[model samples]
Target chain A: MEPIKIKLDKSNELLTDLMPRKFGPQGRLWVGFLLLVIIIGAVAYYRQLKHGLVVTDMRDFTSWGIYISNFVFFVAISLVGSLVSAILKLTNVAWRTPLVRISEIIAVAAITFAAIIIIVDMGRPDRFWHLFVYGRIQSPILWDVIVITTYFVVSCLLLYIPLLPDIAVCRDTAPASPRWKKRFYTFLALNWKGTSKQYAIIHKSINVLAVLVVPLALGIHTVTSWLFATTYRAGWDSSNFGPYFVAGAFQAGCAGVIAVTFVLRNHYNLRKYITNKHFDNLGKLLVLLSLIYLYFNINEYLVPGYKMKTVDGEHLHSLFRGSYAPLFWSVQIFGMILPIIVLLFKKGRKPLPIFIVSILVVVGAWFKRFLIVIPTLLHPFIPIQNVPESWHHYVPTWEEWAITSASLAGALLIITIFVRLFPIISIWETTEEKMNATATQTGDQTQFYGA
Target chain B: MDEEQSNSRRSFIKTGLITGAIAAGGLGIMEVASQDTSKKKGDTVKLLSPDGKIVEVDSSEINPQIPDSLISTHNVREGVPGKKFVMVIDLAKCKNAGRCKSACSKMHYLPETRSYIKINKMQDSDKASPYWMPTPCFHCDNPPCVKVCPVGATFKLTDGIVGIDNDRCIGCRFCMVACPYSARVFNWDTEYQINVVRFKEIKEHAACSTHVTGTVEKCDFCPTKAAKNELPDCVQACPNGVFYFGDENEDVVSNGDETVRLSQLLKDKSGYRFLEDLGTKPRVYYLPPVDRQFPFKDVEPGTT
Candidate 1:
């Protein structure tokens, strides 16, 4: 009761400030727009289903189109959950409390869509159950399926465990206007009383989940890379793909966090919680990730470019100066190198500039996946032969465009709904951080949180 | 044939090949099935049913107009047991005559836009000669395509043919990407592309190998023909005898007219597999384009 009084006295301001609020007019508009996009995507997917994947421009030569790359993009960005929450949490970064929930939201949204887009790309989605019924352990795709499911589960638990206290807070503090919303909060709150035992369980569960997510995150992206690397395709035939894809994923994920954080910060007026300092720290982290990604990119492309073996040469040529050159170069310069260069300067790491840079990084990350999947497919070992002229080049039709756009929009919608339903930041953790800072002089916080 | 003429002929085949057995109340099926187009086919087909019984079927059963209960997945995965089929393409004799492509497409009921084989006009370098290398699915012993199939949809049969069970295929196209030879083709918009040519349903039957709407299709090495102890459509249809198909266990290959010892032909012609460095161990071997049969020329797939 004494500790309750202390927590109440300190966190009264934060509880009211951080409790979930109703969306503004702009927020409603945004949600409506996402719904519309999702509907359009649904229609497109329906058409694609009714007809076969031939609705896409994917032919024999370019059997995989933007749907695959978009799936890769979703997987890549989904890594943000582990990188921001798990890595930063384990490293004892005190500032990571405010960012973890957003990263998890993004991870959940993006990973959910990652699974969806893969099914959309499937030729026989009706037979998707066969992957489980008759799945081969030897196949890299099955490995991708296994790790992706595991990562999705881990990410959900990571997001949920940390959210229990917040859900309880929302349940207790929420205005009882909507009965179902209150019931949702109550059901998800899992009867949390915020006792020392409850807190202990929360902390212990979070630590385990955080530790478990790192490898699953890395494994998901690595297995995804193996889907290509296991093949002998010229561009995908490297041993470097696993680490390379992991590095690129981290880079894209970090940028995704920053970009979404910027939007949330502006839209929700969360500047006080997500400060300039947070942006600067994230920018610095993004720089490190970009440098690591650039190193792997060089290793992935340079050695092969240097050797220029016949197959790799044809593949690399298509990337370097061929049809894909402009995209490949732009993704390199803007996605990895530019972010590294821009974020190196302290001023550039500020909120506005870094937000713009993060947008560029995200867009470039998307096209980067395109460059990875498409150009290699076009340059298989056998010469492109007497197939129709249309098969020679892959141009994704509107159906593909609609579906991809919808998935992206669907992820945004998930995040938006999550923000509306709960506080975007970890309310309990943020209050704890505040209490820790304020009670340091009195040494009163140690007694309550020390366990 | 005119419209009425072709319709009447197809019904004649339907009754003569299958219903004629029912007309006789299921007695003496073999004799009744052989009443019409069977003798014209010149070879009788021996079908192994789902249960292990080798019964003689009329060759007229190969007709496309029959309602599509193509091949049993349970039966053909083991393939004509003890026979490891092989193909040898003599690069020397190829003049880019595309009868093989047409015959294969016609046999497989492929549309005008797609074929199982492609005659690649390959030039080694500026200094070396260009050759017409017709590439089909190699049915490699160490097949990259089969290894990557997540659902065991495409598999290597005991007869050295890589069979695709389209019923089981989830159509991820991972096999299509895994193949180095670029041999696999997706049935992209099967309903549309098939409607365009009005080709009959694919009856290639490399063990449940009918072209499902959203699955992978490829050169199944004409396992259906081989099941009947005949050369593949490409081998029989090649005008210049450039394509030789046979059995490796038998160590003999024939180009419809000439039978030769497989080892002797490879030894004399310096036969080798294409892209041998990749270690795919292809069932198809190639004798280099030397001592030219006709001058090397660039040719389209459906052109002379």
Candidate 2:
């Protein structure tokens, strides 16, 4: 089949209807809530700065805590953009068109926050520039910096390039916009005139970025995983870390896309454009990704679990039977296993159930990162001695919670601002898709008549 | 009036004797306000040579240089010239007395919870018996910490000791996390200046009067003493003379009074570097904990 096409006359109301709109009451409330969370988080960070890292419960032994986990969580979730858009596009998956824009948005939002959260985890955020000026190639942290910056740039361009035509639509149709808003739209549209040459360039650039970004996306999270894995600590010393982290990243990324897709579909009243068919396809993709992740997870844990080296045993015991057991199992089951079960059933694959499952998967993946970081540090081979007892255990204080929550809020605020300025779904892409679908239907009808 | 004048003279003589004891031992007074009695007349002293011949020399010739009466505190931190300092720890003598740990903590104003030095109870292999292994920063010739430091905050000194410039340290703790020996400690919380200094004249020397949060700390080897031509506090404080402070340039090491050739002492004691396989080439050599003065017994763990 050629493609499904919808009518796209210059005067078509759907074209104008889908242009970026001013916020309604619900949009206002959402923006307000995100702002509130961000402000609270900023205040918390201020306290941390004034009082020092003592505001957090992190001590010498468990030096890393939830902030680092949250950083991993953001990096993992950001990987979904490349998986959904680039990987699917490369493999000729037709259903990804509607889902692609939101995935890229989440990618940009999550990656931006990932960078922010990692800085927050630093004892001296002020000295972050030192990383660039004096970076050592041998350190895994430097590798992460290089790849993550590359991923962010690629993700932003992926989000931006295809947006030109849509921004043009917004520029032309936005009625009596403010002077600055008009200029903003016009500049962003890059004078895109829907010419064959412009369309061809836009499509080609998207293709190139999609291809370049996939490996870089994978590289970013893999390198982030190595920050821990490269060490000699019990839980971190894994040969399987690269693949394990990549699999987990795709799982979280796919789940994030699903959750964002659900919210966008409802918020924009885009039931017709997004459709049940799109959700069904997404549900299947998520289930398959979850299963693949589960396979890698087994490889990560089971092989080491069997041998039970002295250091490994201490670390595994904490996650499996000791203080961290509850979180450890819950992340495995709810983050991976339960989502897999839900996605298996057709009813569970529907939009509403899939949305709920995606939320569960995301929450579970966050805790999974926490399990990866904290427990390993706690189980350092040497006995903990000669320090205050508090140094032996890690518990996040209010300031840590505030700073961490603030980073999450900051990501949400970005998404909120993005939605306010541009249509969450691409109006121009949807119009083009509709036109192609109609043309294909007409071609099929002509074929039947000829036969 | 007469009694006060006599009291002042007696007190002056007492001061002279105390000053004479330290000055006579090559701790020179570079400047003295008193009139030069030696300039009035050429006084000569007779001394016997090692070969038992008598020699006559001017009294001034007995002292080659007038050392600074008081080495400036800032200058003391700069270390001595023309020597690269090194240390050797005799593991055989360490019974985990942990006096070195406490003294270092007190001097550096480290928090009670943080220790720059850790005494690891290391077992060579699964089947081998355990031994008490005290670990200071190996201060590796090719230090992993110096390599990973994003800022040049932690640097290796020309004298072979690695030290941190606290003002430059951003306290990322990357150095702490990177160190394989677990030799690095972070100031995760600010430390209270506990007034560790005493003596009115020396109070000005205490620049470590405040501890900033978010910096890394480790064993400095008391550069403060190396400038004074004295052994590091750890080398001096060890009752069993476990630590040997030396200059590799001179090929001589001394634990306070007994000085010996560095190469000779190492050869005699069969000194070895710890974790030799790691390729760090540690400055501190170790003497094995064999033929010990005391039997190995498990000490109950405590937050010393």
Candidate 3:
């Protein structure tokens, strides 16, 4: 980090505390577990490629199955990077220093898998190049492809640019490391000398990217919602879907960041950097997000429930009282309603309770996506007729479950490997914030910059 | 017209199966054992290929010309150049005989499990009487399926027909969800064994109707049949004259037995498109089931 005119002694301590480290036993087990799930998903995908989509239970009626829902989940979770690194950064949230890198990595991993799982859902993934070669601008799928690629590039840059100072710290301070790792950190450090001018440039670039990323993030998720909303299907035909999906995405992403932050804090002993105050702030943020998501949920469902058009009634009935009632009620109660209720109280905002609630939110968000995609498909304008009786219901085959679970595991694995490769919390940013706080509190003109 | 064509087809295949000089396309079992050899006499027959190249082959090797094979993929997607094809299903005459479904599967070489046409037993309300609705791809002017296709695999041609190019389709299934009619079906696992045989026997064609695994298929309005001024198989095979196929441009539609003016028929019978509020502007229209020929029987047609 360029130590500048500020304190260098505190930098040494923060650098030692925030540098990347090897995985402990639990971390190794977590990585191994994630790899195992990913391997099984690959094998299941092989079977799918060998047979056809027939291997899955998706037929003409429910053309999209769990793979699509999983895709939506990934897209939803990927929005956290924008929420933490961009939106929170722009607002100058005081406690957001340590949480930014974790959420950004989660966004990178989830968006990468979002792109992969969509290809997996394709009937002819081998012809994926045709999407680019013969792509029509009218289709939402092409829109998703373009925006998602843009978002991925922007997220990677957001993740990388902030890491240059930290990587330079690692390169200079990590003397016992292997040659390649030292070289790796050195190369990635981008010759950062932490000069006053370079700091200005970095701050300027971060600000520009931060502003650029928010709308792009909103557009990415809104375009994803359009993949369904643009169609004429009953549950999917709402004009309110764009904001509804974006709000729901923000909720999921917030919970995703909280859940990962809890694990990383406990596993890496990063309490000095992360602290309970960060979790408390995130818990309050999740509560706010969940309520906003609930507002959109009411708009999405209640307005249609009020009208109860003949076609939409069937879809609502299935969700409210029929086959899907159990899931619908459970996801609402446990995922959204319960988290909001629990996080509103002070004691519930503690690290452990909030972590459990965030897990529930993440799980609920996944099935909430399932509820969004599948119910509408089962109730089309035309009656299901002249087909086999089995087509009346959709149940994903084992291969579908395997592949979907693998995608989830694959995302976790990305975060896990990233932790080993670089610090999960930013070293330079945390040091700068700590020094600024000390300068303000103690009137320490000696350590203050431009003194 | 359908019976005549079926008989001619039966005799053609029967004759080819027995006689020594018979041919079954270019790749079929053609064990010609004629006493006079056309090669010795230097006899050659000039035939135009599907792509419009005139090639000369031995007289013995000339394939029986099926008009289906002659329409190239480019022709299939381009549609019948001059005609805006439309259909009117007379709900009054339909007894759910299911001849349309069978004929559609037969002509398209579809597997037994699936067909482009579905006979939906629909009742408008609790009080209204039920009728059989044979739904096909409506080929709407503002086709939802065409608009959602990411690769432009499905497109609305100038002739007002929506056609799908399986070769171009990436099998994303977005069009299937986009279509409110539920008309399209995926080739989840193709009838490849049967398609191999059909592809061989129809080798002289562009492999147009051969089903591809992981692609979407629907009622193409039989553009290949339209190329020859013949009705779609479903229209010609309906015994009760339940379906009327016509060119809207010509203002005429026929159900094999009777021909009528399009405007007059719709005006007189109060023919209407299904789900008219959706703004799809479907090409197919339906006449309300009034003055029915037979009672709305829920049982299978032949059982009673």
Which prediction has the highest DockQ against the true structure?
1
**lDDT, candidate 3, at B148:** 92
- Worst lDDT 10-window in candidate 2 chain A: A442-451
* Model 2 spans > 4 angstroms off: A1-13, A442-451, B1-86, B111-114, B120-132, B192-211, B227-229, B247-281, B285-304
Model 1 interface Cα RMSD in Å: 1.7
Proportion of true contacts reproduced by candidate 2:
0.38
TM-score of each: 0.88, 0.82, 0.88
DockQ (C-alpha based) per candidate is 0.53, 0.28, 0.44
lDDT per residue for candidate 2 within A211-308, as digits (tens), equals 89988987998898888776667878788898889999898999888888898778887776677777888888888999999999888888888999
Worst 10 residues of 1 chain B by lDDT: B64-73
Cα lDDT tens digits for candidate 2, B1-304: 5335434643554477557743432212222213233333477889875456999978765432221222322321233445677788877777777666665666666654445667667676888667777777777887867766766777777678787866567666667655656777666665442433352245323323235467677777766566456776667766777778888876778877688778878898898987676576788888888777666666724344
lDDT (tens digit, per residue) of candidate 1 on B1-304: 2335445644654675565454442322333344444446557788765346998876755432221111212343446656899999999999988888888777776765567888888988999989899898999999999999999988887789998887799989999999999998888775623432232233244233446788998987876677657788889989999999998886889998898889889999999998898899999999999999999766564642
Q: Which lDDT tens digits does candidate 1 get at residues A363-406?
A: 99999999999988888888686767787888889999999999
**Poorly placed runs, candidate 1 (over 4 Å):** A1-11, A442-451, B1-74, B192-208, B301-304
For model 2, the interface Cα RMSD in angstroms equals 2.6
**Interface RMSD values for all candidates:** 1.7, 2.6, 2.6
Model 3 achieves a DockQ score of: 0.44
